[model samples]
Target chain A: MYQLIDPILVAVLLLNFAALGASQLRTVIHAIALQGVLLGVLVVVAHNEFTIWAVLMACAAITLKGIFIPRLLFHAIREVSIRREVEPIIGFIASLLLGGLGTALAVLFSNTLPIAQEHVGSLIVPAALSTTLTGFLILTTRVKAITQVVGYLVLENGIFIFGMLLVEAMPFLVEIGVLLDLFVAIFVMGIIINRISREFSTVSTRNLSSLKE
Target chain B: MLISQIIVHVVLLLVMPPLLLGVIGKTKALFGGRVGPPLFQAFFDLIKLFQKGSVISSTTTWVFRAGPVVGLATAILAGLFIPFGGHASPVSFSGDLILFAYLFALGRFFTASAALDTGSAFEGMGAAREVTFSCLAEPALFFGFLVLAKLSGSLSLTAMLDGPMPNSWGAAGASLVLVAASLFIVLLVENSRIPFDDPNTHLELTMIHEVMVLDHSGPALGMILYGAAMKLFVMCALLLRIVAPFDSGNIWVDWGIFAVGMLALAMVIGVVESIMARFKLTFVPTFLVAACLLSAFGIILLLR
Candidate 1:
């Protein structure tokens, strides 16, 4: 079971590195979408239960995170017609180094935490923490609003990985509500991205400094 | 049995490095969609270089002469301390890891000083870059050594390497993986490969290691090339031991596995060179720093 699940988790981690190093906005979006899909699959593999609740949660996660969010972000990028993330606050290589450091910290930090009995020896928590740190890295370093949205999605994917640990404890309705909230949040952010592009004629958040006054 | 193993070790140390270089060349050529040179190309080049006359600059001192000689000598000496495929090193003692590392450092110190001895601006620049990047690489190497030390509870290179048999992987796989990765990066950087420095480029301003040897000719240049291959072989052997970590307990099978692993590693390095362009000069430090963080992380993972 672990042999199967660990590779997927590793792929997700590599996707984090790819997203962090990618200079193209489209690549970043695609990497985040792949990570989301991997997380959805992880939910199924991690649970090993195959109950109705687990199946539904995985489907919802796949739909909202993998399909819905990426499509929305891609549409936003197309509307803005921005192809690359130029002049990021932190350079791509530096951000990648920071992402690696974050992953190490996450691994070390996870060791100190009190993991549930069933998830012992599993990489769930460290993967989740590292993914979240990578997302935070992308969020702060990238200037494109669309890239920031992708970062936000990656951060949520990390949270969702952690949330899988509570599948047995948390109520089913709560999970659905959380997915619904994510959908709405991205919807609202999409609208804001469109507005920012229209107002500034470029999707770069660097231009948004005018509104600081 | 021990004498035979030592003979095999000496033969491999002498004959294997040039082949690895040829493998990398052929792999790169294949990637570029051209017919590559024969696997014996480096061997032929070494022979050709050894037969040529020297070209010493009037301004150069004895330091220029000593560079390649010391470099080759230190690389060969360093090989004595590294075990191959679960075989004990020819020379091993407590605290040998420190000797193993400093031997490379001693070679670099001489090489850089020789480059400076040329009094050429380009060689000076190359020497400066070599020293600067090595500062970052050395730390990563030490941290990797630290993890190995912790893993085997030994300061000796042979013990540290042979101690981590197949069974230890079950216990500290994650930490080992991190260390192997860091060591691979160090290998790439230390050898002046692509994503760090391109060895094949003709542009003098862009060259690092090649530029340092621009003034060297004949046997001296051949010695430098041979020394580089030896360094690459030693580092690749170190990484291969960690990554493969398989021992069948038959000496012949073990040697065969080690040879195949080293060749495959060369091919991997070739693929990396073909796929990735060198990083911008300013960003090279970032890459080395990342390597350091990786080994440091390995240490952290081991402690946890």
Candidate 2:
């Protein structure tokens, strides 16, 4: 069970690096969506048992994270007509270095926590932490509002990775509720992205600062 | 048996680097749909260059002539410390890894000085860029060394590399992977390959290492080319030992594996050069920093 999931988790960690390093908005979105799909698979694999609830959660995760949210982001970018995340507050290389540091910290931090016996040596917690840190990195370093939305989705994906550890303890209803909340939040953010682009003629949050005065 | 192995190692080191360059050219040619230069083109060029007389600038001192000589000498010296495959190095001791690293630095110091000796603005600029990039690349190489030191619990390169049995890969595979990846980047940067600097470019403004040698001619340039190839060979040998840590007990099999691994690595570098454009000079530091982070992460993984 672990042998199957660990590689995917590592792949998730690498995708985080890719998303962090990528200069194109489109690449970041695709990397995040692939990460979401991988997390959906993680949901099934972590359960080990083929429960109906596990299958349902996997389906919901795949639909929302892999298909629906990415489409929304693509649509938003097309509507905004911005292809690159240029003029980032932090350069791609520096962000990549920070991402590496975050991965190291994640590994170290995961060591301090008590873990389930089955998942003790596994990379689940560290991968989750690293993904979350990378998401936070993207959110803080990039000026694009749409990229920030992608960052939030990545953070949510990290949360989903961590949430997989509690599959037995948590109820399925709560899981679906969390997914629904993400969908609605992104839906509203998509609308806001459109409004911001329309009102300001640019999606850069730096320009939005002018309205404060 | 030891003497034969040493002879084989030295011979292979001398003969293989130019071929590796050829293989890279061939691979790039294949990628570009051109027949490119012949496989022995580097050797032919070396022969042609060595037969010609050097052109010395009056502004330059002996340092200009000494640069390629010292560089080639240091590369050959460094080669003595690096073990090929499962065979031990010709020279190895406690703390030799430090010397191994500094030997390359010593070569660079002279190479840069020689470039500066020419008193040309372009050469000086190339020398500055070379030193700056090496500053960033050095830490990545050391961090990778740190990971190896921690993994094998030794400071000696030979002991550190040979100590990792096949079973060790299973235990610390992730760390090894990170180290290998980081070392590969270092290899590329140190060799001034694509993504950091283009070796094929003749444009004075865009060149990094090549620009530094723009004034050298004849046998001096030949020495530089040989030195560059030897340096590439040495770095590639270091990477091969890590990535292909297998030992078949028979010395011949081990050498065979090492040879194949080095060629494969050259081919990989060629493919990388083919597909990716060199990073802008501003981004080169970022790329090197990423290499450092990778090896740093490897050390972190080992420590935990």
Candidate 3:
């Protein structure tokens, strides 16, 4: 079970790169969905002992983050008719390099902090920081609202990864609450995207500045 | 024992490359639902090319001729530094990995220089694209080597790849997987395969490796084809050593396994070519950079 943890986490990290390097909004969404499913598996694997709560948590996570949220984003892309292009503010190559740099830094930064004895060799710290940094990168660098929403979801996935370290301290109910909050957040973002696209005839956040002054 | 292994390496290096190309062609044909050329078609083509006459352009210099010769020489030399299926390389030193890498570089330099010597704009463009793309690819190759060096604690290609490789896989499996992925990308790019450059395409504007050799004919073109196939073989051997680093205590069996692995890899390349469309010229650099990131991530994973 412990051996399974790092590979799943490493896969999640690779998906971070896939998202950063991808030009298609649909590709980015799939990457996040895959990351979500892998993380859901990580939730079960990290616990060592199988508990009813762990299994239940994995099921909810797999459904919401993996299936439910991504399905919402796919529909959003379809109805909004944003097509496939991500319209990044920076080039894909530059964004990929920056993502690499952030991941290296995340690993470096996590090395300095003291971690719990059992969690020391595990990739939990570096994976969490790296995933968060990747999410932040997507959020800041991309111009599309759908991409930004995907970025926000990725950022939240990073938090969920960190939350794995404190599986005991982080109550199952709290976990449920976090997932529901994310679900609601996406629900709101979807509505905003539909409304903005309907009003402006585009999803590029670059146009939103006209409301200023 | 060393002499025997070296003989086996030399024989395979000489004889096996064309067959690999044949396998790739046959695999692609199967995918396209046609009965392609026979499995030995590459060898027949090479024989025909060598028997044909040369047609040098009036504008060309000696560099145009030197390109294929130098390329073939370097590729054969590079093959010496790579172990064939757990057998130590014919030539191994503390820092042969650098030599191994630069041999390919030197080969590319000469090839590009030869293309420029022809003074044709299309060949020149192909040469420029080849050199430019290699700038990204060469570093990614080094990064993959870096992972191997760190894992095995040696700078030599033989030491970096042989014996305890299975153990290294056990300890650093994720990093190895990343390295394997990047190296596959490198292989495709370096050899000018489909998705990077269509080897089969003769259209000047659309090809890279084929376009550069527009002036070469007869034996020179044969040398280029043979060199390309051998380069693929060597690169595939490097990849195989990492992914399947097992020695069954019988030399013949080991060699057979390595040969089968090379054939399988050729077929896989065929499948990739069939399924994926070639990238636009502008996106090629982006693809190369992604390869760099893959290997860089391999190093990062190893650091932890």
Q: Is candidate 1 or candidate 3 better by TM-score?
A: 3
lDDT accuracy of residue B236 in candidate 1: 96
Evaluate every candidate with DockQ and list the scores.
0.37, 0.56, 0.76
lDDT of 1 by residue, B1-304 (tens): 3899999999999999999999999999999999999999999999999999998999989999999999999999999999998999999999999999999999999999999999988889999999898998999999999998998889999999995657668877777887888899899989999988998885558777888888899999999999999999999999999999889888899999999999999999999999998877876777677677668866865675
RMSD of each: 2.8, 2.0, 1.1
Better of 1 and 2 by DockQ: 2
Worst 10 residues of 3 chain B by lDDT: B203-212
lDDT leaderboard ranking? 3, 2, 1
TM-score (chain B only), all candidates: 0.98, 0.98, 0.98
Evaluate candidate 2 and give its CAPRI docking class based on DockQ: medium
| TM-score (C-alpha, index-matched) for candidate 3 | 0.98
Looking at candidate 1 chain B, the ten consecutive residues that score lowest on lDDT are: B295-304
Q: Which structure is stronger by lDDT: 2 or 3?
A: 3
Candidate 3 residue pairs that clash: none
- In model 2, which runs have C-alpha deviations exceeding 4 angstroms? A114-119
Instruction: Report the CAPRI category for model 3.
Output: medium
- Give a tens-digit lDDT track for model 2, residues B130-192: 999999999999999998888788999999888674656887787788889989999999999
The digit string of per-residue lDDT tens for model 3 on A38-134 reads: 9899989988778999999999999999999999999988988776554678888999999899989998899888998888878999999999998
How do the predictions measure up, each by TM-score? Answer: 0.90, 0.94, 0.98
